[model samples]
Target: MTLLLTPVSLADRVEVITPGGNASLTPPAASTEPSDAAVETFPRTTAATGSGGTTYSPAEMDTQPGLQTMHFGAASLACKVASSTTDLVVINQSPEPLPAGTRIKWQLKKEGTRGFFAIIGELGGGESLVADDVLDGQAGKDDICIARVI
Candidate 1:
């Protein structure tokens, strides 16, 4: 099985669960103007700033296969997964002194289910796991994979 990485637009809105409630995060390439949803849901909007804290330079990051870029205080964390063979290889492409806890979790939508229902494996900070199949104990290859930093 092979998985191709898709680069999501910086303008694309990313929703996350924050302390206040549901907050919409704006990346480096996000829009300045506010959205109608934000206007209607003032308190819910909370903060619209980039979740990465610092901006990412072009030379630093891009939409590469199995590569997940995360922004820290002054350092940029690049999680790269080697060739997408039968087992997926996830690597840490950053400098030494890695963070204590940086985990990435993934969820897959079942085929017959209406949407993403099944839960998959998760990677924490500098840890790597073998991502063979999508669903738990299944060998199917038509599952939708969605990943998030947890």
Candidate 2:
């Protein structure tokens, strides 16, 4: 897995916030993923308490920067920030094509807790999902955490 901590002004159209003293990203953090079949997620909220385990990033960046790609199983995951309130733009750009009727799993995490803002639907080789706002239809959370796509 990959953990990105892109440094940017919080005043910009996008704001990235990590825990105190976690304002940096170098070589991306080391995170482990589920086995080839099962998928799991950890939120920034639970990052500090050792809740999600030691494989997750302590900081979260705006997905608005777009397309953080990862390879696992039979596909490559391309995650992008559509908007915090709406949903993410996940594309399958696998070098090896997935089998027919293949589906992918995804989850967007939150901060200070092991809860999810949205649990997206399984996507196909050329499909996407919109993980609507979990904050009761208001704006999305500014915590801007990480996601698990498999």
Candidate 3:
């Protein structure tokens, strides 16, 4: 009898929305193979107003930017042989705080070597924000998974 092994992989991306009405999307740029594996990291920034109606700099916001809504992009990863479980981790490396009710979307696709598979998931913490909130005070992280499918 031959024993089979299942493989797991992960990728990450970030979409940042600034208080000045500007938005940006960062896509995943790394891959993991049967022999070699790679992980990608993304950085983001946002501006916010203080209690006295003062605007804070990106660095200042790092301490406590208040809760903000962020848009995330779908990550693409491939496995040579399908596995029983797969996980995707999203890390918040921004200078602002992300409150609950924050949502993320994932999409799944499967195609050929050049073929592809993808999944999207959303998260909400159910929290609120008040004035004088720290720009980066509430940094948070979340994860999504794909399982039991070839």
- What TM-scores do the predictions have? 0.24, 0.28, 0.18
**Which tens-of-lDDT digit does each residue in 11-95 have in candidate 1?**
6665667898865454333487665543232233233375654443334442333545455433323322224423333333333
For 1-150, candidate 3 gives per-residue lDDT tens digits of 999998876765644767877633444344452422335654543455455543534443322224353343332221222121232233333333343434332222231111112223322223221212211222222212221111
- List the pairs of residues colliding in candidate 2: 45-111, 45-112, 45-113
| Leading candidate by TM-score | 2
Cα miss at 116, model 2 (Å)? 11
Clashes in candidate 2: how many? 3
What local distance difference test score does each model get?
0.40, 0.46, 0.30
Give me the runs in candidate 1 sitting further than 4 Å from their true place.
1-100, 111-128, 131-135
Q: Which clashing pairs does model 1 show?
A: 102-125, 103-124, 103-125
lDDT for 86 in candidate 2 is 50
Q: CA RMSD for every model? A: 23.4, 25.2, 27.2
Report the CA-based lDDT of candidate 3 relative to the real structure.
Answer: 0.30
Better candidate by TM-score, 1 or 2: 2
lDDT of 2 by residue, 35-142 (tens): 224334545443456355554456655353244444556666555446664545556565544443333344444423222323234455665555444333333445
